[model samples]
Target: MNVYSPNLELARMVLDSQPFSMYLGARLTAFGDGGATLELDIRDELRQQNGFVHGGVLSYAADNALTFAAGTVVGPAVLTAGYSIDYLRPARGEVLRAHAQVVRPGRTRVVCRCDLFTVDSEGNQTLCAVAQGTIAVAETALPEPVE
Candidate 1:
């Protein structure tokens, strides 16, 4: 069976419209062909007591990136079913980049892997975290428009 797919434009629109995306100050930097990249600045608010990016923030960004990557292959109806995250190093930098790629695209599910990197002012990137997520298509009934 053929699966649904969403182009970069539609993926960006859908991601930007999400409330959590606004809350996290997440931006869809790039999206295309079963892949997606998101960027987030490590402002004071997003840092922990040690002046490093918070773990939760990295996880959130990674999750969103993976979801968007899966959406590129599975379309807008897809929803994240589960995710596993691993923090390799502290994210201490000015910005964080989350890059995701679809590992497997199936009829009903899409599996994605993401790498979160901390980029310094000098453009040095350090691998901070890695995540794997599974997204599955969801079916929902839409209400008819009222006249």
Candidate 2:
């Protein structure tokens, strides 16, 4: 499959068009052919009762990064079919990053793996979560009345 990097304009468009992504404040940090990195600042809203970044927040970031990376290979019309995540450590930092790489690209499905890390004020990296997802290419356009 041909690989092409998405420009910042395209990345912003993708991020703005996605409703759930907007809700999570996901920002596209970098994008390449079959890879992408998303970032989110850990705020009080993202924390769980323990005062650490919630696992669900990490999962959402990872999943978003994986899906965006896969979309760079396939088109932007892909949707997540299945996803699984593993939490390794708690996130105790002020910022978080999710880096995703495309594992397998197919006509119907694209598989991606994402690694979520927390970056401390000292610029140290801590492995927080790992996620794998399969995105299916949309067969048809969404519901819209045609003229």
Candidate 3:
């Protein structure tokens, strides 16, 4: 599906401004009405003691991607209510990709599904985790930032 270009720009700007995403080296690759793709480079610091990417890292990516996907129709004011994920395999790859899509959309809440994959340097993708999340959309305008 073609991405809504404005939402894509907003997603990129949000990711770029997020301290956590910045520290994790996450990048917003694409975003549209109900979908978002986030990518992260695997680094030593992001791995568990066993050398696989950590679960927390995977969850973080999924959560943000979920929110971004919901944000496409909900605007920028959205927060995740909760999410659950199951890890299918240990992530061992050069990069991690979190692909999220809103499967159920509403005025106040949106449900999103995400698949976390590890992409090897050779570009092979292995499913590492799956997630489902509920996002709450703000029905009212958010307060402006104070100077």
Candidate 4:
């Protein structure tokens, strides 16, 4: 089912206002009715001592993707209820890409799933992690923070 987006531009603005996503260099590449895709570059700053991308970084990407996917159907005020991720392989690549989709959308909650991949310079993608999460529509619109 397709629903009208209250304000698509507002979604982008909200994402840009996220301090953590900005700090991590995450970019919202695509947004649609019930899905979203995001990308992040793999830089030395994002790597752990073991030289692999940090688990937290992957989790962050997954979490954001899930929320964004839900937001497509629930509106930009959606919040992540909870999420779980499984690391399938060590991440090593030039960039990271996350694809998220809403499995179910409800009046107040949405179930989402996301797949995180490592993309090489050649454009080959390797699945590194998977996530499942629930997103909830906020009770009310929150005011923007004072900077």
Which one wins on TM-score? 4
Pairs of colliding residues, candidate 3: none
TM-score of model 4 relative to the true fold? Answer: 0.92
Off by over 4 Å in 3: 1-6, 143-147
What's the best-to-worst order under TM-score? 4, 3, 2, 1
What TM-score quantifies how close candidate 1 is to the native fold? Answer: 0.88
Tell me the lDDT of model 2 at 133: 97
Query: What value of lDDT does candidate 4 attain over all alpha carbons?
Result: 0.89
lDDT of 3 by residue, 40-110 (tens): 99999999999999999999999998999888766777888999999999998999999999898887899
Between prediction 1 and prediction 3, which has the larger lDDT?
Answer: 3
lDDT of 1 by residue, 19-46 (tens): 7777777888888788999998789988
Clashing pairs in 1: none
With a 3 Å backbone cut-off (N, CA, C), the pairs that clash in candidate 4 are: none
* Residue 126 alpha-carbon offset, candidate 2, angstroms: 0.8
Predicted structure 3: lDDT: 0.88
Clash totals in order: 0, 0, 0, 0
lDDT at 61, model 1: 92
